[model samples]
Target: MNEALVLTWAFLLAFAVLAYVILDGFDLGIGILLPFARDDDDRDIMINSVAPVWDGNETWLILGGGGLFAVFPLAYAIIMPGIYLPALFMLMGLVFRGVAFEFRFKTIRARRYWDWGFIAGSALAAFMQGVILGTIISGIETDGRQFTGGAFSWFSGFSMLTGLSVVIGYALLGAGWLVLKTEGQLQSRMRTLALPALGGTLLAIAAVSAWTPFRHPEVAERWFAWPNIAFLSPVPLLVAGLAALVFYGLTSRRELMPFLASIGLFTLSFIGLGISFFPYVVPESVTIWESAAPSSSLWFMLAGAAVLLPLILAYTAYAYWIFRGKVTKETGYH
Candidate 1:
């Protein structure tokens, strides 16, 4: 395809990924933070905070994955086989959490079981996503057309560290959502969670920065090169500054701004990763052009997405508008 078309497609794919991370990130964060909730009341408050927006948030994931599958079939084919287990686990986690979310509020007696399921599902999903990311960053073991690696090979020490990092990242998002949507003790509790989660996330980013390049020399070189280095370096700096702002906002009791700032941090970091691995879809294995489906197929998929994606975005915005306000004890999914 022409360069302009390629670039436009790339940008759309990137936006979809960013939307997924920001939208689903918070609900997953809520799920991760569920276990730390002190009691049933706290849990209810936490769930309510995300109920209006959680499902809509997941639309980004669908958009991102579906867009990639349509536009870049080769990348999808290679990466899917390599990370199949983790991908399946992530889906299961999301499904489990989604099911538990509805069931949890249906009956008082079954609430505890569903709550635990939500927590487990959220944490599992987050960790699996991180692991998949780490595996991609660490380089997948692919031999020509297929993944030659063992089944459990994706679960390494480095992958686990990335998983933990994601857990903290989600917690930070959850904390921010709570800051925006709740008040009183719950807000205070979220603030308490936000600070440490922010610290852990930063540390994880640092570690990943160091480890990723060491593990993959090409990526390291791309990052350290003069022009690329200068262009991409601002991402981390922005992330750090936003993180500090988030900390300050939380400490000063600024409320809603902390969540916004946290989202900024996440967005910047995500952009950095996207920039670092621009042309490549499956780490070192496949480039976007190489893995792209036929032009005719892409055109067809693009047409469908053109209609569906906007409708999803509009409905999501409408849902958020409908539920805009502080959550209360009386307000819940019954």
Candidate 2:
């Protein structure tokens, strides 16, 4: 029961995090793309594209954080202290971005201010998330169950690269989303922007891949071993296929494929990262089982998760289904 519950909750937590990153990622991407829109009208339409679903999209972030705190307190305690500033700043960024979304349309006098708030918030949040991920991948220094790293230990060459990579990745997702949701000149412009974002995203992936092995020999050996190679090779192959599809879709003026392809790219990357670090929840610092809460606690969490998680997914699906369409000047945000 302990074994099953631990694995189950871990998987649940992982799923929540994935959902948060992918769903919130595109809207944040849209916000990141705000500055580049041709005019105020274009900006409003772009905002309108995600207006219906952005807030609901963030529910997954809450679930992810809640799950971490509940099911893996030990890991959470260590991680929070280690990267407190980035995490706090990330939340502040989200707060400002959320406010911008609410106020960007209401007041004409401060609409421009709100636009900059949205853009800055999105970029800052995305960058800080990358820093968090990079710090994890690079491994946190811990004494027993507590973090021992310095205040700025999270800032490093690799972490900065990861932060940049995440920004570019989200922007790419946003561009693909715009291609799917906008029309005419905006669509063409997004397609043009996507190519470079795609290129930059791939470059960042390569840089991280090159640096990761030197940072973590365990991952290097797992990635390079014979049977593991056979098992893992498909991730990169599928990523390549999706990248090609995104390029082809953009060039052909295909609407949904570019966005779907970006989703595929993210999914594959998530899978690859999971495979690379299966047993470790906080990289080398903590294993999943070591960090898991008590079995009795997990039993309660599991029962609650079984009910709550499905409800979340149901509402999430319903939201996307309801909002599925092109964003235009005609479609007003309520």
Candidate 3:
């Protein structure tokens, strides 16, 4: 295997996953927060704030999942069985949410049902995504490319905690997005919502950080070993700084900063996760190099990705650019 080629694909896959997490995260957060809206108009505004971009955001998800299957077949094969249930639920959630997004506007009496569907779907998908992450972090029970773990392996205390953590984190992001894109009472409400969500997210981050090092010796060594520790200590410190910035942004009514800072917090956390499991894509067992596809296959995919990725980025940027600004009664899909 060409190490550099494999590494390139690894970076691309990571980029795709992070893009999906950050981009789709806020929309899912919006869906998660839909239940908090005071009225149908408020809900409509909330939905409209994300309507134009939500579907487009999921492109990264397809890219991430597809890239994994093609580029790292072994890791994908090992991971799928463990996460299939949650992944199935997550997709189902997204489907219901998407259906709600469309049909909620088309009906009057039935709108409430769709609204609930959206909320449940959003929350389920976010939680399941977190569960999947936790399961991966906890490590898959693989015996030479086959998942030897029982079916219920994904359901554990740690996975549950992580699932809740993701829901909170996504809620925070949603609240921040609302703050950035709404005004007056709605924005104020989101600001209020943001405080607790932010607090919960921070707590979750700290808890997970503490737990991971204790649970995984390699992670502990990666973070706390002398020279590595000295270099890596800044990650947590920066998280603290970003948390403070998010607080200040909310309290001071700084619209865009809170959302941007929230993204920074997630980005930093992602970096920390990458730090914990760099060489190993499948946690302790399978490595990127070990699981990588043949160089010829990687090169073929890279050629396509080189063209596809830039176009995806371009269109995604275009959509957001066109949809920028506060969602109002006059400007939404009501």
Query: Of the candidates shown, which would achieve the greatest lDDT relative to the real structure?
Result: 3
User: Comparing 1 and 3 by TM-score, which wins?
Assistant: 3
Instruction: Go through the candidates in order and give each one's C-alpha lDDT.
Output: 0.85, 0.89, 0.93
Model 1 RMSD in Å is 1.6
Off by over 4 Å in 1: none
Give the TM-score of each candidate. 0.95, 0.98, 0.99
Clashing residue pairs, backbone N/CA/C < 3 A, model 2: none
Ten-residue stretch with the least lDDT total in model 3:
325-334
- Candidate 2, 1-334: lDDT as tens digits: 4787788888888888888888999999998888899998899888899888899988999998888999999989988877888899899999999999899888999999999999999999999999999998888899888889999989899989999999999999999999998998988999999999999988887788879988889899999988889888888888889999999999998999999999888888888788888888999879889999899899887888889888989998998889888888889594
Model 3: residue 192 alpha-carbon error in angstroms? 0.4
- Who wins the TM-score comparison? 3
